[model samples]
Target chain A: MAARKSSQSHSGGLELLFSNQRKHKVSIPSTSDATTGQPSNVAFLIKWLCDNLMRDPRKEMFVLDDTARPGILVLINDADWELEGEEKYELQAGDEVVFVSTLHGG
Target chain B: MNGFSGTDHQVHNLKQQIAATETQLHSLKLQLQQAEQQAEAARHLSEAYQGGFPAEWMDETLVALQQDVTRDIAQKVRQEGGFEGAPSVRDAAQPRRWPLEKHEYKRYGRQLIMPEVGLHGQLRLKNARVLIVGVGGLGCPAAAYLAGAGVGTLGLMDGDTVEESNLHRQIAHSTARVDMNKTQSAMEYLQSLNPHVNYNRHEFHLTPQKAIQIFEQYDLVLDCTDHPTSRYLISDACILTGKTLVSASALKTEGQLIVLNNPPRPPGDALGGPCYRCIFPKPPPAESVLSCGEGGILGPVVGVMGVLQALEAIKVLTARAQRPANGGDWSTNGATSEAAPKATLLMFSTYNTPQFRSVRLRSRRADCAACSAQSTISRQSLTSGSLDYVAFCGATAPINLLPPASRVTATDFSRLPRDGSNVLIDVRDETQYAICALRGSVNVPWTGSADTWLERALASGLSFGGGRQHFVMCRFGNDSQLAAKAVMERTQTPVAVKDVKGGFKSWRDEVDPSWPDY
Candidate 1:
């Protein structure tokens, strides 16, 4: 995990917060966009999450998956992802993305 | 005239008077007929009320009165005054009385003022029949609001008994009714809230046989249940019976709401909104599933969803009454008579920057097994026991895979020596560990890794001279199984490691009665 963190540069990277409800609760520090230049869109953020945070990226899926899995919901900067062009919406500085899973029992 | 005789003049005058009297007699006869018809309608209405003026009776009465009553008078009344301003045609119409007592009006006065709900919509609410599947956190609030809103009939279905631990979120159940069956407890609470609502208590688990039959009686179903199997069952039953389903689920600090299988406009034009299967396609893997008992949940999160469920149910029930002109707006209209209900999913979170989000859901799936045009599920299939919802949802407890030697029943564990040589590790989180645990168990709290904790325990010098024996347990046995397996594989020392079968639940059942289950 330390090696992976150091492998990526710290300059002009996104700050990501994973909810405690998720299996991974660690807050990512200065996560650089692997696909494009700094300050990318939601699509690149998802790609970065898949590469870094998820324990088993091959098996685990995210809210952005095309199938629209039942349990998870995603919001971009206090607005519904649907209203913000979903994956196509570009991430701005100080943007907050939230993922909530409604799978557990009441 | 001068040529005619005086007697001929007298006869002409008499003929004119006779014609005038005959016209007056015809008018009197017409008035009498109208009076008689009104008398007959009044009699029917009185008899209908005596028999508990049913919804069908109201429909029949509306048709009859509309046909027989003079439309001229009704039209004149409407022109003179609207429904709210003064007594309109609707007030004069016997069928539109809605049977709400004066106090009922006073009670729901605030709701009655909303244009979308007025007298007509309130009547629909009083006529609605809603079934709430679970009486836990979600069902408690949903049922309460529906009852408070004066929904005519409310069905409470739950097999479990109330527990003290549930009082935090299950607001409908009181500490006094701790041991009572959930449905019975909820019914008591709802009845107290509003005695006018007809409470139906289903004190048994929902089965396929009962699901369709019970669902058939209700206009809508609220899937307030937590289990995935019950969710599938309720959705399928709603699809088969043509009942709207307002399904909500909450977990941890987030919740979801969706209205599924709302009856289509024009009846059978096409399959209604998407069923749960269309949205999920399949249930999440069993290993990933967690209950509130296993994964702690906040009270207000489920409360918010429950309240929303009630709102959606009200929207579905009163939709036709509030139907707008121009075929109604699907986006804003709660219930509409024209277009398909807009399928949308609402998601809410109470943690990490609270957010509420909604996304438009896809239309009904042509290949949806439960609600499609050529769907496999049907009333016949449901009643014949052809559809195994539990199997479909993968809700049955998964088979334990560890070898028999690697597991010990709580009864056997109780008999094992409690000497310091034997180490019992409670793998539940710290919050749960603080709740209660075995007398000598140490808390490790499974966090996907056992090496750090195992090394710490080894360095503590708690092990005996001989090989050490370790037992791992959780609130339920599932997590402990994995923890125990990890301990066995990772430990360098020769240790006999086994998971406590059924975890603390089995211990409470077979080992000790005083231990707290939650």
Candidate 2:
């Protein structure tokens, strides 16, 4: 059997804080945009969230934690980030990166 | 000789007076008949109000009245205090369209092209009444699609409140309605999505006793419920009542949907042919089934099953498809297939491929208590009588369900001020800021997200400190509560935040109506 470890066991507080797995997409200016007042895209937004909002900053395009969906289920239009390598979700100037939790209902 | 000739002139004068008096009497009779017709029109409105609408609907009417923004502005603000600065009818300049309309089914449109649901079927869909059991994942999307299809009456049965977790899949509740009644909140959302639909929210739980009452009201019942016991109970009730039951369930990238028709004859036929029990009698042991809570389910899996359930319901309600022939038969190939063992049940398991499965559901079990009386073990004759099946289904179990809180308009907040310390927040778009605003509250309008409001609020140099007791409010209570929750999170403030129940409309209804409610 594959080793199973619950990701939520470590950071319960963070889980409680970001428990609303609702998809809220926020587009903010990048650091250059923040410092120089410029518009930010997915790349800059991803970096800013990691530095400010996320507790652990991994060099990934999307942040996946137990706080929201099961894993960091990232959607870039029609592709899943999990299918790509970690942090490999490429961001173009006009690309939209939607970070959704993997929660299912039947 | 001159005195005798003057008599003819006197006779002409008498005839003129008699003609004028007759005209006056005719006019009076006409006035009385017109007055009676006016009185009859008023009586119809009163009768419709008393007959169709129940007493509990007072809240809905009060909410609607409070949200009235048909009045003028400046005088309204002075009387009502701060305007929420939201757009009213004047801004949109769009005329208010009445909700009630007798629409003939439009043919030659997009729906007519669909082979399965054509013009004839569309008319049936319009008149169909589908009762949805839950408002969770499967229920939310399915109901939305069904409403969009122009179903006349959509009945939502849920006694649960909205929680933060439901926000993930239950897209019906907005952030503004963080803690409102789920049934009421979902109904409002569904109406806004499609004004033509007439929906009623059953705030009470679907108990066995209540089941008979509610299920009998709808043409079809969809079993979107979770637990096995509840599913079995629903199946049994559908059998007894002779209502078409559209049953669907999904979990973890898998789903299943089945349409159970009551007997072979008309619903209330003498012989209650084969029911869900005539096929599978006893409830499967509890351990065999797992819920989304234990084994996670894919969100799309539920979406897929729910859509199928809705389609099946649309079909059954319009009488396009005949009831299941014999016990659990679902063969669309031909009626002669009834003899084939391979053609009985219709099942879909998303585990492998999204193909429908056909299986033969065996005959009535001899020991099955529902169908088998003397041949089976009589539950009444047993030492330890069968447990209350309803209770076994957790009829008394607390629904640990949650959605978001309710949003009150400014009017609702005024009435409930005595209940607790409450404050209002305005969340209108900035472009319409010149219109009006609520005074003594914060303005965080949804200028696009957490940052826009924060930037604008910080730039204003306003004081939002001291962890003040506050409730978020909006024009219609749609966006304010969402903004408030987001604000509470960003501020790291543990505040007892709630949406002003009903937004500015409630405020206008209870306090001052001079304010525009648009």
Candidate 3:
């Protein structure tokens, strides 16, 4: 199976789930979706993270309906994921994907 | 025998010499340690107490004198410029003065030497009028830096009192001022830090009616509040009053900051900066929201954001407040420039290897409810008290999820037996449960994504015996109601579920007086 490496970081209380470690390196088996004959992308990476990196039992907080949650903002290469193809964008080797929740306390 | 005796004598003499030398070395070592400590004391004694005076008198006397000096500075500001609740001096009794003073050049000499901030740039800083809303963690440090830099006017607005819990992150308040109003306490500190900057104090909370009039008096606005309702309210007010906004928020180990309305223009102008709504179109779910008290915050994490706010405010003001070098009443008004600030969200996380991250943000959205051509928010609706921000933000109020029949008093719940038949489920989060809990209580947080917590408990061999009761408790009383209702629905077999009214608070008052309040 082909695999690719990506760096993922979480912040704003989202890190509480991932063993409280903010940054991690994950190698995803490229094209986990052999059934659909689809290339590896953000959706594939998220499922890989949920299965591997999520130390907490409640997966619903980080992923809502199989994508990054509503309040969380995703950045792909320092640009908003919305500008990219969102979950459909194909993952490139050594890409930096960040997820952050909006903070409302001071 | 003679030879043996002679050898023994020689060895005994050598041993005595070694023992004497070792004792001497130890005493010398002790003397060295005393010298290290006494050297500092020796110097202080010569300067302070060599003349037959008590050792503690100098420090105590100096601190008391310093208090008097700070008190005088605050009194001077109150007498001359006035303070909290004092009406602003709109119609100047004297003509506005704009000339840079000799003392000002000396005070700002460090920054004035920079090419970016020479005489003219310094003048711009001296001419800017900035309004800061919510004088707490973000405001304290921001105000200190701004007042030190000689901002022409600094207006402070807040309606909170200082608490023992606030001292760690909110640096402006003092231990002595625990119950004092936040604005008044912060004002005293700022007045002493820089007496030159004009201080305007509005001791009340920022309301829709007061916001427009207060914001109209200043050129720039800073949203330092800790709640989403205030964030929405402040942004709407800034949009209405045509003031540029620098907003920031910090919680737990992270913080976010952005600049809005850099060149605050009319609605529908795509070139203008985006307000908070344009970016965060929907607030987070009400149940998910957590305060700094509920969710712990690092002091330096918030401090970094607050200091950055001061830096951004200064850069925006100095760049935008410039005027014709000639002389035409330039000091009497706000900045004349209309430059747009770059739209980027600056994120800071304490635990990340790269602690700072910046993301390019999109401009104003066409369908934004507050700042669009077909906008629903207007000055009339805002000031006329028509906006129900509390409901819109899902407000931080006590949620009534169940009726009285389902809830029992904490005293009544205390009467239950301690056997395994009666279950006491404490729905507080894990952090709080670690802090303190009753002897026979179990914790399953009501706020988490554990919808099947009850089912999991049943499958794990927890019993709900016949005629036994299930008591639900939480920090206050709201979460217990929700937990009790969920337990009622989750269980297939009929069981008695009751919420402990007032939760731990009433339990402390009515049952155990020694329970830790925090």
Candidate 4:
């Protein structure tokens, strides 16, 4: 089976749900983008992360429908995902992604 | 005689040797390139191992690579023939002249031996003035490490008093110190850790007018405060005073850390590191903010982040110390240096397999309101108390969404009939509801959102006082009010639904002080 790879890490307490594996070398099948119906992009990445990574029962913390829940900042290669067209940005090999929830409790 | 006069025979022999050596050199270069590639792979594999287990279900090449890496790392653990002994410190023998006090060598010897922090770096730490704001969970641990490291002048600023709840995470403050001013309690603990360092206690909250003045006295500031308003104020003050800021926050199982104003570039300078405003641009909504009491925090989760703040502070301070005071090409903002730290945010999740992550951050924004070239903030406005941080961040005023008469005082609540005819809906989440609640109260949890518990209960033929009275309660009155409003709107029949003002907090205060507050 053909697979495309991208790495992602979780922070801001989202890790507790993803089997506590902050970084995962995900293997996405050579499938069409879940949203765009084209090549796999971050939209596919989000769905893929939610389906594969989450080990905890609380899936609502990291995901909401097709995109990451609000307040979780996604960085594509150290740049805000928003600057890179949010989930529409095409997935590239070796893309370093970070999903961060800005925690305020001290 | 003619042949002996020129030495052409010896020159020819030398040329022949060079031709042979050149062919050998080409092979050696090819071998070196292959070795470099193997080393790169080994390094990547080691990093993966450090993060956690490698994906075993990868392709054949990756599986083979993992085995190779495992073997390579095992070989490194043991040197040829036997395990290598620890390397001796470079200055095992005392120098003729010593700058640090005699005891200081023994005090900081472990860290002093590090190459990054040698004799010169120790002196910088000894001279550095650091101000830690908010002597709570984050500040308590941060102050401890900074003090232990012997930062010459450590100033702790916090107006809060230590309480029993803080003892779990505020490591520096003991049970005996509870009720004492946080700064004073921490100062006592920090002084015990390192008597050589000076400690200053500013037992007052930081205001817009006082922030810059207090910051002016220090070279670096640690923002351990729990709120967005203080965070913004601290960054602005740091940028205004040209002092570096190391900030951290943690909640539940996750934490975030960032170093702001590292170059301490004067305000209006685009070369400076991004200020808090530059990165966040806007504060999180006031209603979204949650205190440690409301959200709950893990002890080590915040402790680790605070420790990272101290580490980042050490990195910044020591690097600055190693450079020359004035003439240094490597120590400029916006300059390229291999050692220059990329603007990044470090995130940690205690429950995650690889708990730490570093995300590269953009430099100062071109239009930041605090640090950009077109910044609106000025020292004049800050010192004169003209800047309204609360207004800017949108202070969490009391939740006044409901009209009067819908809310009842805690005293009024206790006086109500408990004949089991009236329903007391505990609106807090399940965990809290299990902790403590009014006797015979029904649990219909509210998660700060539109809860379906009321609808579910109503549809299941559960009588809400049979259309007489339904009471809503939460840990705090805020959520209860929201829940009460939801109930009033959801019900078809006109029913009396009143939110107990101040919820259980006021219940403990006005009615029964013995009720568990946590």
Q: If scored against the real structure, what TM-score would every candidate get?
A: 0.70, 0.42, 0.74, 0.73
lDDT by residue (tens digit), candidate 3, B1-518:
99999999999999989977775665455445444434444455456445654444334333333343344444434444334355434322221122356698789999877866655556668768998898888988888899998899999989999998888988888999899999899988888888998999889898877778889999899988888888889999998887889999998888999989766767776656788888777776665677788787888888888889988998887666323357532221243334333368999877666788889776787888888787899998888889877788786678787778888898988887677677888888878899999987877777443355565456645555577788889988878887788777776788788899999999999999999977
Candidate with best TM-score: 3
**Tens digits of lDDT, candidate 1, B446-471:** 65445655565556554523666888
Q: Among these predicted structures, which one has the highest DockQ?
A: 3
Off by over 4 Å in 1: A1-48, A55-100, A104-106, B1-99, B263-271, B322-341, B396-399, B408-420, B437-441, B448-466, B506-513
DockQ of each model against the real complex? 0.27, 0.07, 0.35, 0.25
Model 2: DockQ score: 0.07
TM-score of chain B of each: 0.73, 0.49, 0.74, 0.77
After superposing candidate 2 on the true structure, give the runs of residues whose Cα lies further than 4 Å from its correct spot. Answer: A1-106, B1-108, B262-274, B320-360, B363-368, B371-387, B390-518
What CAPRI class is candidate 1?
acceptable
Error of 2 at B166 (Å): 2.1
Model 1 alpha-carbon miss at residue B193, Å: 2.5
- Cα lDDT for residue B431, candidate 2: 38
**Root-mean-square deviation per candidate:** 11.8, 25.1, 25.6, 19.9
Q: Which stretches of candidate 3 lie over 4 Å from their true place?
A: A1-5, A17-21, A24-70, A85-88, B1-98, B321-342, B402-405, B415-423, B444-447, B450-452, B455-461, B466-468
Could you give the DockQ of candidate 1?
Answer: 0.27
Q: Residues B1-518, candidate 2, lDDT per residue (tens digit)?
A: 67766776677777767755654454344334333433443355346566644443333333232233223233233333333555443431222222122353342246645766554455557657889988777788779888988888999987777776667667677677767877787888898988788898888666555666677788778887777656656665665455767777776655656566532223223233344544444443332345675455667667777888777666655444432446653223222433312113344445433345433334333344444342332223222334356444333332211135534445545656543244555666553444677556556666435655666766765345655556766665545655666666776556555666556666678687887744
